[model samples]
Target: MKQLKFNIDSKIKQLFQYEETKNIFDTYLPGMRSRLESQKGVSSFSLRKVISYSGGAISESAIEKIDQALQNVIVYVDDTEITEYTKQQPLTTASAEMKAEGMYTSIRPGKVWRDTEGKRIQTHGGALYYEDGIYYWYGENKDRTDGNCTVWTWGIRVYRSKDLYNWEDLGLMIEPILDNPNSGLYPEKHVDRPHILKCEKTGKYVCWIKQSGEEACFLILEAECFTGPYQIVKENYRPFDWEVGDFDLIKTEDKKAYLFMDVNHNGIYGFELSDDYQKAEKEISRQYENLHPPFCREAVALFERNKKKYMLTSGMTGYIPNKSDAAYSDSWTEPFQSIGNPHPEDESHSSFNSQISQVFQVPGKKDLYIAIADRWVPDYPIDKRRADLIMRSVASHYEPEKYPMTEEEKREIMDRPMLEDVNTSKADYVWLPLRFEDEKVYIDWSDEWRIEDYE
Candidate 1:
């Protein structure tokens, strides 16, 4: 195939007319213009050459495959300016002011969230476990620069919060075993969707992780405290020999724990865990059948409201947003009826362009729940050298800036080193208050909302 070379700098300058697009480019690909300028004369190369020049910063094979898929199309610079960049609204300042007043603050979805120490909360694809008036949040810690799923460096991270607005980082609960290739905690092996459940029978906190390797399974970890130095108990906790994907756990009012996972990316499957939360004793699907269409659903966020069990799942559109479906049942083992898109009519059909991570019930409140979703940033190109050109056009028309921090201000805003793979690493949480009325659930989009509003 003939190689194609497009001038990225000129293209960005011409295309990104509005400040929003420029800010996005600068946020995700910091110092990209200078880097491209330094290598301007040598920038014209094939996709493989670009990936090779990235030197582990990008995935070479993925870019080559993508380039092949595009049939190596050539482009010419045009005077047409992108108009989508003009839609971004200014950041909402009400939440910050509420925080300053020490009042119950609102949940601002898709914005950078910091802990008490002012560090970005690194938890993604995680669950909230409420215990003794405290909430513990645990999830995958993607602290690496590559932004590709192929590179897994850190294990699960834990954070604690009281009002569900301000979080305090509890550090990594399950640290990666960097040197142990045979261990399930190996750095390169993909481990995500960490859910913790306190076993009623044993009174021990158990964590269930979706381990993606040769044979995907649930790796069980046990710890005495919510903030844990957890130890792996079972490496392969498979109920029906199906490979596990994203998952969630729920304990019924009767004190029975059930495990929910996506089997082979097919559908959401339910398994009843042993009373001690150690084994996947029974496959609930044997009686209930698969909850949704095979290979159509993942990112399971299961919860219960008004004695009705509900599961919120996103269509299997990797890293891109799609419509979310909700299934509710009278019982965990019963067939769930599909409730089409629970979001408001004015909102994006794709659940505000985010995927449901968890739907958590408010502690000490009945029928009150919060729908947690991740507003995924655009996927970074596998060729870091071509990173500026990959998502520049599409990202111009998305969510408006929240705080409107400049690139330099954003870098100085945090105490810790900012996430390197800005595209994917900066994925922010979208927590919206979920309401149930007349047997239907509604997730309305709010720029900023206080927890006290629901109360």
Candidate 2:
């Protein structure tokens, strides 16, 4: 507990690199930690420089207090003391051990969901695929430092679960082509909303992820088993062209597979897949046509219950919550009836402060469907910017008038560096049960609930 090593001259990012000091900064430094994450070149700037840019918001005395606490801080332990959660690392068949360690027993909405690896489960905008009595949960892996691209994800990460309460990380099923930028799986390209389906006819696992960046399209890959070394069947594949955004895939009881995709800002277009489930046969259904930006919808999650089809969607707001709508139809190809906001009780009608990812029926639980959602940018709430149609949230800009920077100097910060935060591991998940009464759907929020509580 001697005096701190690094002084005020040290780069701010240097302290954040260590978990011990990072916690200290978060506790003592107020808004500095979040500012460093998004604001360009702020992290690399010296501690003193950052405080100056804060325009008297972050005082000098606060820095001295943080430095003193860092001296007496524990070496290894972080502020988030989940020592028991890490007791058994990388567990596969250790459900009993996990429970004994006081880990997962219920689904806690809008909270950090840790995997068996004792790390935050990085499955944002993901889907659940059931096969051989095991459920495979997969989605985008955003575990990287700010890099070259604006909206970047490493690739799709897959995990396995038996009880649906606990997940064991199986690592990346579809790894990106690091050496080749033109490859569909490249790190710069965003491959999100991964919806996987098991083709009973071929007995192969098919994964469909929408890759949007330079060339927006769906990349279809196939593997013999659930944990795949997936072979790309088609890359940059668009069933019919407008442009692709978020998507979902499902195999029906009639032995048919359909892809529910958002065609840019137009509408949610449904495409029926071929027999092998490799390519799109034809466009089947189009729901929720948009007249303008605010009306445009993305994040389309399609599911069927009680012989009827349900489509869940959200507005154009990027990484922020907005009003969610539901549509229903008798047939997959037919037009769906507007059900209005399913979460009417929520004052903002922002889908309980989340965006829908998928809706799947729980095994053996009749009429029970779980709406998997992502509470992206949980720090922010629904506002006028909700319909700005931004694809990503930029870091909070430094205060201008308070800071003593000239207008020319202020403009320079915008060009310092475009920070693309790839570490979306902090993003929380909101999975809630769907309440059905008569053909209409409803989602009621619960802080904590379990599968056993259903039915």
Candidate 3:
């Protein structure tokens, strides 16, 4: 690499404010930051990029500052303009680079869904959207330059790609405010697992997330753009004002929105969102207590399969993966039946020792569904905190059945260690596939064994 000769010093302040512009300032700041910490004695620096679709004096002053800063370093708007005086290289914007990968390398093989261009982008508890032949993934980026993990200071990270596989980090979609009341300065107000739903009426993006601290009020927020400077739409407790848990939203054919959340005793509850997408309709409250072990189940995924609706729930053990359960109902609310765990022998309670994140559907297929989870790496600090998002497919006609364990299996279950242990006598983990009498959709684990056979 050629080191550009410039009279500039590299020890200048880093830009921390969010500005909507692409200028030389953005390009050289990272390098300036690098040089500041380098063995070289460079002391100050500045750079900028062009701002598209805007014309203002503030923008002009921005350009002037760039010219002055480069009085000592070479600058170029394009590669051909590069000369000894134009020393710094232009900034590179993110573009898709990989194929989409589905969850579970051992299961339902599909295209790759995520990638980290050259940076570690951990947008977990995120959602996916398809627009203009491209997919945009939004979530939290927990990686920080400092080794210190700021207890409640993480920002929403965005990544966009043409095919789900090669992702380019779009930077923070939602950031923590040190002065705002909703800021995660305390442990209770932290943001977790944000899901986005585009409003049909207003053409805006709405996000719902679990807010910890001060009693875990699950909040709903909105922004005009998918990559947002999102404004607070409404901040309230769940319908009953109970501490809301991980939740997901789905749209009915009629465009009506429904939110599925973790209800009392680790069960599942859901209700319709008002026309504004800010408040929940009280009359629509529906709860299901029979989906799996009532112990600490939190994250939920709701969607329609073969014209019928289904939900998947995961046990709450924090970053650790657990045995998860899937259930279905003909109606959006009411009378849901459990489909049991896909893996009954794993210690995490799931097939591959993973935790559920969200469920994704193949764009054109109604019966096709993929369950996503984060297979967290242990003890890598924040590195482990950012787990690899995984997905696996389920059979179209899957159904859960009552378990009848053999005597030997029963004995082994009695000798299990922890309550979350797969071998525990709680046969809830020992699920069997169901054979539905009707022609409705069914998802069976044993017969669905081919989930791991996909290439």
Model 3: residues >4 Å from true position, as ranges?
Answer: 1-116, 145-148, 181-188, 264-266, 283-294, 344-348, 365-368, 377-455
As a whole number from 0 to 100, the lDDT of residue 153 in candidate 2 is 67
lDDT of 3: 0.50
Candidate 3: tens digits of C-alpha lDDT, residues 375-450: 4422211212111111110110122133333445433322222211111110111112223324332334431233
Candidate 2 ranges with C-alpha deviation above 4 Å? 1-101, 145-151, 383-423
Decide which is better by TM-score, 1 or 3: 1
CA RMSD of each candidate after superposition: 14.0, 12.1, 18.9
Could you tell which candidate, 2 or 3, scores higher by TM-score?
A: 2
TM-scores for all candidates: the values are 0.67, 0.70, 0.57
Q: By TM-score, highest first, what's the ranking?
A: 2, 1, 3
Question: Which residue pairs show collisions in model 2?
Answer: none
For TM-score, the strongest prediction is: 2
Q: Candidate 1 — what's its lDDT?
A: 0.64
Q: What would the per-residue lDDT of candidate 2 be over residues 132-200, giving only the tens digit for each residue?
A: 799888888765422322336667888889988889989888877765657787765677788888888
Candidate 3 global TM-score = 0.57
lDDT of each: 0.64, 0.72, 0.50
Answer with 1 or 2, whichever has the higher lDDT. 2
